[model samples]
Target: MSRTSRVLYLIVCASPRARRIGELVGRAQARGWTVCVIPTPQALKFIDRPTLEEQTGFPVRSEYKQWDITNPLPPPDAMLACPATCNTGNKWVYGLADTLALALLTEAIGLGLPLVVAPALNSAQAVYPAFDRSVTALREMGVTVLYGPGVYGPGPPGSGGRPYDWELPLEALQEKVVRPERRK
Candidate 1:
């Protein structure tokens, strides 16, 4: 039987805003996309790898193993770096690949695949020089960087401290992953 070819890579960062990664993953899967998550060590603290693995029915890789290339997983049709922390976003925009997510993202961009990033940072820090340069670099490299909405407080009121009704680049991701590629 042929398998459905929908695949997406989820890259999270170590930040308070990274909490939304799971919800985004769930929504993606419900849309018939197979998600492969690559979380940083810091992101793992916010989410559970086992839970992600079970939900996606794929391995949730945190590290790049040199010897694991015997069987390579198919490249995702698109990559969504959700809740892109201030640090991770800047690092990736400047072509820093110290982490597995950045490395894979670099390769994805090289292959001309769609890369959508949703940046999550406070107003004060988001306006920093490094952040500005990083955003510019990513745009120059054809990476779609979505600016976060201006929401104050811990999030939802009932949550006692959590971002509420923030903008996610879901439409952008759906546009890429669900669209059928045109054959030449």
Candidate 2:
């Protein structure tokens, strides 16, 4: 497939790292993806909407459009939820679609679209049993979850830990999802 034909839905969740989503957008674009930014409602506060909209050339969609209006962004060829929060992950596991971001993610699973999730949370939340279950469940459903010791180690509570390496998700998508699909 040509590079222009690949559309990537980049979901940014409510995390401190969301502030740097523009960097990820640039990287994905350079990698040949036509990117779209889907920010969780709370993520709006962390991100600069105008900057993201300008970067992606599509409005940062946090809410659903009106019934009569069409969605401006094209359908996703793949998706990556970077800095995914525990709340969103757990909600996704249970098939929650309250928010536009979650709605797209839940539907993506059934649509069989390539999906990747890189969760960002503190050590305290990381230890929660539900988080582990959600991660395992998502992986079982064919989602690439970049978590655990080597991928992303959670820091102590209140300690923000080191900045997350956004390249991890991009690389995982290229290697595990996009390339494999292209070969088919």
Candidate 3:
């Protein structure tokens, strides 16, 4: 397979905002990329495996399965952790990878897969000292952390609507993580 056709591993965290994960997955696959959805245990509470599997046309595996490590295939070409929670972000920064999702991310980073994380959390949680430290560490490690849309989806009128612009994260990923091969 060509470079672009190499596998793309997606780590979807469980959160109310995770409803939008499908859109990201669909868009990536439409660009001639293969996507593997590995939802966090918590994320599965919001989005089921079957639904994600149907969308990505591949079985969704959460924990490290018995046969996976032995396959001996190269790591995925790209890794994206969308709707990454404050918990995961904080844990990652401190190098506390207890769960399979986090462990996979740790491995991906170590293997030099193009990695990006789109965080989704409340403003309060976003500003936690741990969160700040984690973000800084990730950036220092050359990990692209896509700025979120700030506020969740649409809110009540006069509710201060969306905080930041969508282009912030879109452009961040487009410029740093995603590099579609130029078409002839």
Candidate 4:
């Protein structure tokens, strides 16, 4: 096992690709990384909550826990926001912590954690200048924003697009996360 003690938080958004996020969890676990799922409020409808809990052995959270309560999940070494919708991307860029997912992402950036974002949006939405600016800003802050043909390209005009590979985020995660062997 490699880095079994480490944690990876997979923040899901309200996109069709989010339904298949379980695949990423399995891949992360195979790499001996504990996977924690934190979906956006609207993302709750896209994921299989109980099944994910069964697979990861941790509750899937969509909101902040009650105050004064100890955190149930361990701190994450890295974070990936897959199926990150246009709204999520824009909000995150603006430092909007309206949802648990965005809040986690904002904090992760400030903490300098390895972060990856694979956004799913149509060509129409992706064309918005704000989207490009957001992506650039996130990348400038050391976040790996995966948004290309194979990762998260724009779809058709009106319809919301799907991601080429749901596993790309995990692939990005592997390449970016600091490994035990690389520790100073």
Candidate 5:
């Protein structure tokens, strides 16, 4: 089947906000994007898979498909991993790809695709030395990290707080990813 060219692969993690990810798909589709949600293994428990599939007209995949089966979606024009956890973020930093989400992230970074990450970690978790270094490493490599004081601030520890704006990832995708390409 011929795939739409402007595809977006949204990697959803296991945050409480994961349930609302259909909001992201709706927003992206309004902007002429075809969104495919790739969920983390544990994220399935948080999100409504059937609803998400209905929303985006695609499956919310969490595992690697068989080798004989061709990939379903088109190459992503951009990638957004929102509400990322400390574990996911740090693993991405260390080149871990045990999951399809991390594998896609690592490969997308290597391909120089437009990439955005919004972490939902609190202050205490953010204090980890690896978290600091991981954010710095990703930033140095041109990754758009929606973290820090005004953005997705390191809130009080164990508060399970979400970021300031749910739309930040979409905004980043528009500003840093889609819009930049339009200029050419």
Candidate 6:
């Protein structure tokens, strides 16, 4: 499918960066993607639900819809988890779908949808062995995980450093996932 017709599920996690997700949504729309915002339950507190809903023209969904209800968002042609917190990342690797966001991510892996994850955490969190293992496991599962060096590296604990470069995940998706699909 052409990029203009593609649907992208932009999953936001419970990080300070979640506050700036509107910027990412705007950028994705500018690139012709029909973007949908899915935030983790905790991320709800960080983001402006009304603004994002208006921005995307879709409800900001954090929980599963009732069985009788129809899904409001389109099926994703691709998925991105930006500011993917250590908690969510690890849970996803283990196939823990306790939340709607995790359920979608876990299902996306099985569906073989083009997926990219940019982890956001402090150096202390990154240092854990589980973090390294999660990154490796996700990559082995054919998920594009943008971490370390030029992509993104965790800052020190309590540093509250510069905001995450939100565009990195979108850029990666365009190059690694979207562009290749176009050639087919």
TM-score for candidate 6, please give it.
Answer: 0.92
For candidate 5, the clash count comes to: 0
Residues 58-156, model 2: lDDT tens digits: 888999999999988889988999879999999999998999999999999888888889998998998889999999899888898888778788888
Residue-by-residue lDDT tens digits, candidate 5, 13-46: 9887787788778888888889999999998989
Higher TM-score: candidate 1 or 5? 5
Backbone clashes per model, in order? 4, 0, 1, 0, 0, 0
- For residue 14, model 5's alpha carbon misses the true position, in angstroms, by 0.8
lDDT of 4 by residue, 12-86 (tens): 998878788888789878888898999998999989999999999989989898889988888989898887898
Q: List the RMSD of every prediction in angstroms.
A: 4.6, 2.8, 5.6, 3.4, 2.7, 3.0
**Model 4 segments beyond 4 Å from truth?**
1-4, 149-151, 157-163, 178-184
Greater TM-score among 2 and 5 belongs to: 2
Model 1 clash count equals 4
Q: Indicate the worst ten consecutive residues by lDDT in candidate 5.
A: 175-184
Provide the lDDT at 139 for model 6: 88
Candidate 1 C-alpha lDDT tens digits along 1-184 = 1248577788877666565566778877777767888887788887777777777777778788787465244567888887677788777766789988888888887887878877666666766789878877887777777763442312322332255333356666765555525110
Error of 5 at 167 (Å): 1.9
Cα error, candidate 4, residue 8 (Å): 0.5
lDDT to native, each model:
0.70, 0.87, 0.68, 0.83, 0.83, 0.86
Q: Give lDDT: candidate 5, residue 16.
A: 75
Tens digit of lDDT per residue, candidate 3, span 1-184? 3345757787878666566567667777766667788888887877767877888777777776676455322357777787787789888876677777898888876776677777777666766678878877887777787653552332343332134343344344455544533110
- True-structure RMSD for candidate 2: 2.8
Better of 1 and 6 by TM-score: 6
